[model samples]
Target chain A: MATLELQGIRKSFGTTHVLHGIDLAVAEGEMIVIVGASGCGKSTLLRIVAGLETATEGRVIIAGADVTRLEPKDRDIAMVFQNYALYPHMSVFDNMAYGLKIRGLPKAEIRARVQQTADLLGIGQLLERKPRQLSGGQRQRVAMGRAIVREPKLFLFDEPLSNLDAKLRVQMRAEIKRLQRRLGVTSLFVTHDQVEAMTLGDRLVVMHEGRAEQVATPMEIWRAPANTYVAGFIGAPAMNFLAAELVEGGAAAKLKAGATIAFADGVHPGGEGAPLIVGIRPEHIQAGSGPGSLPLKVDLVEPLGAESLIHGALPSGETLTVRMSDCSPLAGSVLPVVLPPASLHVFDAEGRRIEAVRRRERTAAAGAVGA
Target chain B: MMHGPIDATRLAAAERAAMKAEAARRRTDIVTHAILILGVVLFALPIWIVLMGSTHDVGTIARGEVPLLPGPYAVQNYLTALGEGSARTTRVPVALMMVNSFIMALLITVGKIAISLTSAYAVVFFSFPGRMVAFWSIFITLMLPVEVRIFPTFKVVSDLGMINTYGGLIIPLIASATATLLFRQFFLTIPDELVEAAKIDGAGPLRFFKDVVLPLSVTNIAALFVILFVYGWNQYLWPLLVTTSGDVETIVIGIVRMIGSEADTDWNLVMATAVLALLPPVAVVILMQRWFVKGLVETEK
Candidate 1:
């Protein structure tokens, strides 16, 4: 059974619609991440689930019960905020035990729970110190301990690691994943960082303009983005897009830059000469001449130790970036690069994925490789 | 070339430049100190004269020559001011007036802070019908000070039969907007995440106020306490209009009454009452000076 469900959630603040209708479900103990840029309503959706916000039109069901109208305290959820939000005046121990005390748990039980969680987070010695005195990472641990001690039915995180330095963020990211897995609690984490979303979520909900652009595992999202926004947003050194038209009965696409690349199989879903978008990740292109290769005029080279990025323009003045192993290529030289048919992602003119040809071929190839 | 004859002209020119810079710095330092000292003396003169006058006999003060030195009668003047009431005024002891002032100030400061803190919390943290309307109504009170609309407020207090009571003196003046505005501004600076975090921790609105909001507001409360206490203690007009009886009279009103009409006025006793009145506010400011400065600067920010 799904542990949490949001059905047709819609929100508007004074006629300014912040969230369009959103629907989602989380299986028991699954970690779902809602990732989006700022103002995309990801945080608003999380707040609605936490019972901090009331959806304009929808039902929020937790543990098979409708809790859309309940207060946040009665929702049986724990949240860790980006700023940690540990009570400034309370000791670390008191901060962790605050929720339990409010729930009318006995003193002994609250103490034991807080101590156990504090020890787990390795903040046992800092229990007597106030939040103002601890380092940022320590405060973050205390915040997580506060949530963990509650033992609530659901966990919500709103960019909890965004405040920390990069190194600490990575460390805390692993700690949170490990803790969540061990606790086996259903969780929803919201973040704008694509790498964090990719590494942390069991399934990522990529949101754009108050809509969920796509929901899939990280590898699936990387391999096949649902739209132009998701394709540009999910990768570091994002995917490159080029205008193209399907030709030769959809067996191949002729780029506007005048390069024709063949599909893996002669399968065409659209009519001949249909306008399309060709999406290719930087890492997918290789530096070599082949049957369907295009010559690229190298403009700049970025050497990053083990690998180098070759930034260049095609013959028709369209820019392209190719990630390759470290090798010094002279500037202003024409390098022939190949685009394998299986590596190309084709989208319609409206930026929606057209999976008729490539998806089937990729899955079949995967099945063959697995067999 | 053995340093080219020691270059006496360049060395002399460098020394002359250094001497000129030194003289200019000395002149600026002298002028700065002179201006600061003048400002200090100008502000301190009235207080110094009052202090010296309070130590003298009534006859010496009545001569119209400002007393420049402490007299031999400092102890007797304060004793008579605190114990025996001034003869020309209604014979309620200054001690009783001091107590009344203290009580009124304490009540007003505490009442205003309590009211402002809760109202500001509601305005900033919760959303309800008329939230902004209520906030704007409170904010509008800043323009309508106690001096304005004084008659209506007094009439209301009289209708409630609270005339000559401490409530009449404090309650009508308790609903101030500056403190509420200060608190509201400070509360808005509290990150919304703290409230959300508290909610997720199973805290209700009241719990969040007490545990999170109140602690964060300590400096602000202390700071406002100093300012509001002085404001309450120094209230003269309202107390005079409301308290017809000497028993409920504040020290500020009592001091004004100490001066008799014409030549019979006891200036020494009036100055003594002034000194006593100055003590509580001065002590409050001194005690909470650190938090006061921090609160003032931070709340403004």
Candidate 2:
């Protein structure tokens, strides 16, 4: 395994620029998942790292060697494409052995290597069959096996499981994760699905509009997002944002109007009476008539087998989503709910997290990061 | 009630008329087969005439005295033409000309199809500088026949000292625009996913072509082979211009020569040679009909 670094990478096709300057580092044996919407340059970045595409400006250092201008063959990396790309004419064994054969490896060595990889992938019986004879999941495994046999310093995957059905996708995702862990190879995986990124990566890189929005450990990104986009993107049923202001009443900073809630001294010291965007996770908001309870009008109730998501509106007419364990009585009725004091996240006018009074608790450690 | 009552005699006549119509329909089936047999006979007549004529004496042929059915099977005419028991001294028969024609046709067919497949692959897959211009330039040749450029092509061939050589016949006839464009259009439908997969598998351009593209292109190649073989085998004008001597003359030229030396034409010998020249192409078509039809029909899907 080896570390890979991309510094100041930019790409353009004629006048249309696809990637701005992007700098990222993949540590040895680490799995990095890049998540983004379509055309967000996530796939392009992965392709550049694989040397299937060249960056117009920048350097790619893999295993401490510059490979930016090299052809994909010389890059010493393997890629698993979305389509699986198994050689239709050859058996799975031959497809897996193609790279070794091209490099003039001996016949016995190539066969042995292919056999070992196939066995490890539990596709030994499938080795004799052509790609057309295999199922979608089998073909995907073959594609991964072809890459694994090479044992390159880096592995690139461009949404390898996107074509599979939901159940198969989940199964393959776990299989891929297990295989990657067993091999301990440095990998760069690209996907538009946030769940896959969260579940697979040691470090998840969220991208938006040709730039990295945020890069952190999955749990860290979930708990303390760098910005509103990361907070909204990383979780399901996304975090709800409500318009509010930081008002000065006493030594403790207080939020305006929803309910009487007091914070520790010096909370959000940016200024008083400043417009702010208050974000709270749906799962974090408790449903009850309590000290900080605020009346809400229920609009929709979604029971998802284990948990329920309640869609309701705030007094100010802003839509808020609340997640609960059981279906709420106020699902189709008006009711009161409370947001525990610490559960709320306040973002200043510029859409940045306001330095809370307990700054060192979350934002201080997560400062200097942006999504 | 009286109006509803029908006459038994009239009902019986109607039933008899229906039976007669069904019998007439069955009789037409026999008539149809008879006409089909007649058509087959008509098609085989010219071939039978040619085979019988090839064995008869030229004098008998010119006088139209040879029997339509196999007459006394004169092996002597063949022997004479083949320089065996002949009156003429040191006669060199026409067998060498047939051999030469066969060799030229094979070369042209193989050369044309090979070049066409590669050219089509380049245009369909690779994106390079001047790709559109290159594709259009080749495609435009489909509308412009070789006849239009024959003089210049002849001049170029002569300048290269290729006249009277196999190169003269092979080079000018190779690289067909229609075949190239046809193969390109067929190749365009192969899913891009296949190519992408090949690339990620560490197969470079040449490897991808040989392993992925070529394997899937079997049906198209078989189809193009028949097309190009017929085109090359039947080519007349260009070969006529290039091949100046009897040594290099093709089967068509040989058939044209069989009528010759003067105004009096040996129609029998001419037809006989024409029938002889038709065999190889017919054999090729019959041999690869399965693959040919497969190419034509399978490519649409």
Candidate 3:
């Protein structure tokens, strides 16, 4: 296992900058997943670390060795490609043994290692079969087995599960997590899937455009997203955003829909009449009429067996989605839904998060209690 | 629905339709067999004529009445052709020429495959300066057949003192852009991930070529071997230009030498040699037919 650090890594392909100075430090044996939309430089960053692509600027230091100029094999890293990339002409045994054979291992040791890995991957019976004879999930297992048998210092996966069907993807995803935990090898996995990132990474690096937007634990990112982008991108059915003006001396926000909603715990960090954006997750919205409840006109309902998604419009003519129990509300009915202040996230005009105005309220409450 | 009285006319019409369909199918089967038999006859007629001519004495064929049946001198004609050749031509044994032809064809086939495989591998896998220019230069050679550049090529061969040697016969003909292009096309279908995986597996370019690429190319190589072998064995012009002595005479050119300009040609021996020349290539095609067809079609994709 090794600690990997990327210091100011940047890349450009003829002035088309793909990665814009990404800096990250991964602890030993931690899985750092880089998740983003396509063309967001996630794969480019992984390739740079694998020594398949060169970085225009910065150092790739693994285990305290600056390997910016080293080859992939010299860096002691193994990669599982998106397509599995097994040697089609070779049997599973030879495919797993190829790396060791190239490293000039003895024949008996190579066979033993391959057998052991095949057993670990549950592909022991498939050792003599070629890649074309195996199903997709089996091929994926062999690909992983090929990487695991090498026992390299670091493992890099480039969307290895993307090619599998949805059900197999989940199975293989869990298998990869279990295997990585058992091996405890420092790994860097790049994918365009948010759920894969959330379930697999020790810390998720949510990237946008060409930069790392946030690097935090999945729960932390889900609970306290750093910006509007993370808040919208991380959750299913997405978080709802509303334009509002801070009123009552930064204590509450007057929504454009004419509902004045107060902070449940503290005041927001904005002056009166200051413009802001409020974010509320779909699952967090409570259904009932209350003091801070916003009126929703239900337009459509999607029943998903356990929970239904209610897509509707607010009084301000902005669309909102709510994850509620699997009971359909009548179309065109107005339902009052409460966006709890504790679950509210406030952002500035530039989409950056501004701290909830807690100091003023906390100080006043503490002073009153003391008196 | 209430069943109406059974209509005899409708039953008759249905039976007539089924009978007509059966007749049509039988007609098609007959037509197909007729065409196939005609094709088989068209191919086999020449071999039949050669066989009959080889068995007959020289006078019967030279008299311009082609024999339709084999004669009694089949053993004598074949023995003469194999052991002593014809007395009217250069006295080199036809057996020796057959050996020389076999050697040349084998060399050319093996040599072209080796050169093309490596060159195509380099062109497909590596990036260096003028890579496209080098590939285009090789591709352009396809337009210039050896017949177009024969003199200059022969001059170069003579300058290198390769005349009358196997190197002269084989080397100039071995630089085939078609084979190289075919192999290059095959190599391009190999996934780029395989290369990356090989690199991470600690296999360098040469090792990867040996362990992975070559194994995948077996069918293509076998197919090309069949084509190049036939091409090399049938070569008449270049071999005639290079080898002056009877020692290096190939069977194809040696067959022509059997017919003297001013003397009665050894028709029996010549026909026997023609039979010999046709055997090896036909055997090769029949043996490697499966791989040959597969390689041709798969490489197109």
Candidate 4:
């Protein structure tokens, strides 16, 4: 296990710049997931680290050695591709043993290592089968086995589960996490899915346009995102943004259909009448009213087995979603909904978290004033 | 409807129409089968004629004897043409020619495949300066026929003092534009991931190509071998110009030499020698047809 560091990484294909300057570090035995939309250079960054692609401008240091210009064979890093990349002509055993053979390992040792990895992955019976003969799950397992058999210092995976069915994807996801733990190898996994990043990665590096927007643990990113992008990106049903204005130490916000609501003291007291964006998660918008309920028209209800999602419009004409478990008669009917003040988030004109900072600044000022 | 069932005259008329339609369909089927049989015979007739003529006396062939039906004295003509102690100065023995053709064809086949594999692998995988230009240069050769370059090739071969040698026969045609491009295309179809995986295993270029790309391209290589083998075996014009003597002659040149001067015409011997010359190529095609088809289909992909 070795630490991997990428400094000021940049790549360009002909005239098109694909990867802007990207800097990241992976500690030994740490799982880091680089999450971004398609073509955001997440995979490219991983390839650069894996030494598959040469960065036009950057330095890659692995285990205290500069390997920026080294070939992939010299990098001591293994990569599992999105498509599994199992050699179609080879059986599972041979596929797993190919790397070892290339390294000039003894036949007996290669066999032992391959057998051990196969047994670990529970693919011993499939050792003689070609990639085409295996199901999607089996192929994925063989691909992982191929990487793990090498016992490389670092592992790179490029959307390794995007090819599997949803059910198999979830199953393989758990298996990959468990395997990484068992191997304790430094790994960098690239994906566009947020849930996979949050679940698999010890630290999540959320990327937007070839830039790392935030790098933090999953919980830190969830609780306190650095910016509105991270805040809106990390959670499901994506954090909703509503237009609002500051008034009377809080903010006066209105939904799309012109229904107004007031918040108390969570947001920064900025210049009066300055419009800002309000962020709220779907779960925070409760149904069937408690206190401070706003009237909304229920448009549609989607029941996803465990919970029900109600899509509705506020009186201020702002579209909103409320996630609740109850399948009540009011679904698909016009009804009043309440959003608790504590759950409401206020963003400045630049889409930056205002209230969260205000609380931090106030705490610091109070500490200073008390001292 | 009920009234029609009660009418016997109308039923009789309907029965006559049904019978007439049946006769028409039967006539059409007969015509179709006849045409198909005619087509098969038209295609197979030439091969049948050639095989039969190869075994007959040249006089009988010159006299326009029917070839599908073999005449007497097939063995006499074959033995005489294939026999030694001939009067022609450039008479190539059947055994010698067979060996020569086999060796030449094998060399050309293996050499072309080896060069194509290496060049294609380089062009597709290794990134260096002017790679695209180099690839296109090799690719553009396919558009230029070797016939156009015959004079220069003759001069080059002659200058190298390779005349009357196997070098003269094999050197000029060793590297093929078609094979190189074919292998390049095949190599491109390999996903970069395989190479990446091999690299991670610490496999360099030589090992990766041998272990990954080459084995996967067996069908293509097999097909190209047969095709290029035929190309080398059936060479006529180049070998004719290059190898003036029978000592280093190929199969096609050997077959042509069987046609003696007009004054010393030996039709029987010529046909017999020609027949022997054709056998090697026919054998190669027949034996390797399976691999040839596999290579072609795989290349198309």
Candidate 5:
């Protein structure tokens, strides 16, 4: 296991800049998932770390050595490509043994290592089968076995599960997590799926527009996203953003959709009547029946066996989605809902989250009543 | 319920029509196979004539009564061509010419494939300056074949003092644009991930070529061997212009020499030698036909 550090990595192709100064430090045995939509430069950053592509300006330090100029082989890393990239002409054993043979490992040692990795991956019976002859999941295991056999300082996975069916993806996802835990290898996995990032990563790097919006543990990022981009990105069905302005001496936000949410922790640092974006996750909004609560003109209902999602438009024409665990509100009807003050996230006009500074007794009482 | 009888009648009519259509299709298939068999017989008649004529004596064949039936002199005529030289013609033994032809064909096929594979590999993979220029330079030669530039090629070969040598016979015809173009097209179809995977596996360029490129190209190589072997075996004009001595003479040239001044020719020996010349290429094609088809079509990869 080794620590990996990427210092001020920037990449640009001609006039099209892909990454704008990405900096990160991965401790030993950490799995960091760089996740975003297509073309967000997640794969490019991983390639730079793997020495497959050079950064326009930065150093990649692995185990305290500068390897930015070294070739991929000299960098002592293994990458499982998005397509697996298994040698079609080689058997499973040969595909896993190729790197060791290239490094001039003794034949017996190579055979022993390949066999052990095969058993570890549960592909011991497939050592003689060619890549094309194996099923997709079997091929995926072979690809992972190939990477694991080398015992490199770092492992790079480029959406290795994207090609599998949904059920198999979940299976392989759990298997990869278990394998990474058992090996304790520092790894970087790139994907466009946020659910995968949330499940498989020890920490998540939510990227947007070639820049990392937030890099924190999965729960930390989910609970306290640094900006509206990340808050709306991590949770399913997305977080609802309302147009609002800071009122009550900058202690609460007044939504244009007809609700006022006070900061539960304390008063935020901003002047009164400043324009802001109020964020709240769908599951945190509690349905109510009182007249003074926010009115939602229900447009659709989606049942998910354990919960139902209510999508509706407010009086101000802003749409909101609410998740209720045991209620199914009918469409084309008015439903009353309450946005808990403790669950509200207030952002400035620039979409940067405004954190609370001081705890106040009155706002704490409000949080308790809302809960 | 009211439509049942009418539906049954309609179904009966449809079945009759289908049977008629099936009969017509069967008739068409019979005619098609008849024409195909006629074409095959027409194509094979000359080879059969040569095979049957090679068994007759020189007098019986030279008298313009080329027999369609077998004669008793088959083994003797073949032995004369194979073991001894024709007395009236070039006097070079057919066996020696056949061996020379085999050597020239083998060298040309192998040399062409090797040069083309390395060139295509370089053109497809590397990014050297003038890489496209070099590729287009090679591509431009496709339009200029051996016959088109025979005089200039002969001057170059002769200027290098390579006349009548195997190098002159093989090297002058080695720079094949077709094989290079086919290989380049195929190498392009190889996904970029394979190359990157090889690089990550610590395989250098030469090592990648040996371990990855060469093994992946077996079918294509086998396919090219069949075509190039025939191309080399049938080489007539270039070998004729480059070689003057019997030492480097090929079977094709020897066959031509055996037909000199028809009155003094040994026709049976020529026919026997011709049949011998056809055997090597046919053997190569038969042995490698499976790979040839696979290379041109669907593959496991």
Candidate 6:
């Protein structure tokens, strides 16, 4: 296993800059997933690390040695492309053995290594089949086996599972995670899927518009996002943002929906009547009749088998989405709901998260922790 | 609509309709087979006549009483035409001409495939300066067929002291734009990720070419070999224009020369050489038919 450090990597094509500047340090055996929307430069960053694309300004260091100027073949990295990129004419065994042959490994050793990797990937019987003869999932396994047989310093995956069917994608996601854990090789995975990022990575680098909006563990990113983009990008059905302002000495915010919700952790550091974007995940919002409950006029209820999403507007006509378990529409169109104090994420006018200041808690649990 | 006990009358009518449809299909099959038989006969009759004419005497053919049945002089005539009977009668034997044609055709086929594969690879994969210009230059040669550029080409070959050499016969015809274009089209459909993956696998450009590109191009090479071999084997004008000596004579030219302009034309020898010349191309086509169809039809794995 080896550490990888990317220093201020920037990429541009002529006048159009794809990646502004990205800096990341990955520890040994860690899995870092760079997740973003389409054209967000995540794949470009992975390619830069793989030495397929040159970073215009930055250094790519693997195992504490600079590889920025090296060719992809010399970089000691293996990549699994989105399309699996197996040699179509080669048998599965030959595909896995190609890199080892290129590296001049002993013939016996290459054979043994390929056999072991194929067994590991559960594709032992498929060694003689051509890529076109295999199913998509089997081909994906062969691609993975090819990289594993090389045992390079680092592994790069560029949306390797996106081409699989939904069920197969979920299955392979777990397989990849298990294999990464078993091998303990440092890996950088680029994906546009938030679910894959959340489930796979040791740390998720949530990117937006050529920038890393936030880099933290998945739960940390979930519980506390650095900005509105990260908060919205990490969660499904998206975290709902309501326009609000600091009222009651920064301890509470008055929403444009005519509900004043207080902060339970600590008071935010802001002046009076400062504009804020209060983000609360739909799953965190409860339909209730408590003291802080506010009226929600139910517009639509989307039932998702075990749970449901209650989409509606508040009293002052501000829209809010509430996800709750066993949530069916009641007799009345108006359903009382409460945005819990602990779950409210406060952002400033510029859409950056405002970490609440706790005066007495010396442990500083609010600090971002890397798991 | 069944208004009776079992609707048997309507069932019989339907059965009769089906029988009528079957009869119609049988008639269509007969017509189709008739056309196919006509095509087979149209293509086979001339070759059969040539085969029968090769066994006859020159007087028998000259008097236009060419026999359609097997003749007794088959072995004698073949031996005489093959130059095993008399060494002084022919300047080049049929065996030597065939060997020359085979060498020219094989060289042209292999050389064309190698040049075309590499050229197409470079055009598709590399990004050097004037890359497209180089590609367009090769592509533009598709407009200039061999007949159009024969004079300049012959002049170049003559100036290079290659007028009567095998290199003169093969090299000029080796750089084929059609084969290159076909290869280029094939290379374009190869995904970019495959190249990148090969790069990551520590494969240099040439290694990738040998291990990946060459293997994938098997069917394509097989298809082009048949085309280019026949093309080289059938060269009469260019070979005639370039070669003044009899040592570099190809089978096509050897067959043409067997017939004299005056009345002393050896029709049997000509027919014999013509029959011999047809064997190699037929063998190549039959050998490569599977790959040729696959290469043309299904491109991707």
Best DockQ goes to which candidate? Answer: 5
lDDT of 3 by residue, A1-371 (tens): 99999999999999799999999999999999999889999999999999999999999999999999999989999999999999987889999999999899999999999999999999999999888888999999999999999998899999999999999999999999999999999999999888999999999999998899999999999988999998888988889999988888878878887688887756777677989888999998879896778889999988898998999999789998999884578888988888878888888878888777568778898999999
CAPRI quality band, candidate 4: medium
Q: For candidate 3, what's the RMSD?
A: 3.1
Better of 2 and 3 by lDDT: 3
**Residue B81 displacement in candidate 1 (angstroms):** 2.0
Compute the lDDT of residue B154 as modeled in candidate 4. Answer: 97
What are the RMSDs of all candidates, in order? 4.2, 5.5, 3.1, 3.4, 4.2, 4.1
Cα-lDDT of candidate 3? 0.90
The 10-residue segment with the lowest total lDDT in model 4 chain A: A251-260
Q: What does candidate 2's lDDT look like per residue over A52-150, in tens digits? A: 788999999999999988888888889898988666667889889988988899999999999999999989989888787889999989999999999
lDDT of each residue in B1-301, candidate 4, tens digit only: 8787668878988999999999999999999999999999999786667657756665676675667776676687666555551346355566676677788888989999999889999999999999999899999999998899999999999999999888888878897889999998888889887777777778778887888888888888877877888888888789889888767866577666666665565555555666676677777778788766765554332
Against the true structure, what is each candidate's TM-score? 0.91, 0.85, 0.94, 0.90, 0.94, 0.93
Give per-residue CA lDDT, model 6, range B226-300, as digits (tens).
888888899889998877667888888887777665367777777777888899999999979976677655436
- Model 1's chain B TM-score? 0.93
Instruction: For model 2 chain B, give the 10-residue run with minimal summed lDDT.
Output: B83-92
Query: Where does candidate 5 chain B have its weakest 10-residue lDDT segment?
Result: B291-300
DockQ for candidate 3 = 0.57
Give the lDDT of residue B273 in candidate 1. Answer: 87
TM-score of chain A of 6: 0.94
- What level of docking quality does candidate 3 show? medium
Regions of candidate 5 where Cα sits further than 4 Å from its true position:
A289-292, A360-371, B1-26, B290-299
Off by over 4 Å in 3: A360-371, B1-6, B261-263, B290-301
Query: For candidate 3, what is the interface RMSD?
Result: 2.7
Q: How far out, in Å, is residue B72 in model 5?
A: 1.3
Q: State the weakest 10-residue window (summed lDDT) of model 3 chain B.
A: B1-10
TM-score, predicted candidate 2 vs. hidden true structure:
0.85
Residue B101 CA displacement from its true place in model 6, Å: 1.3
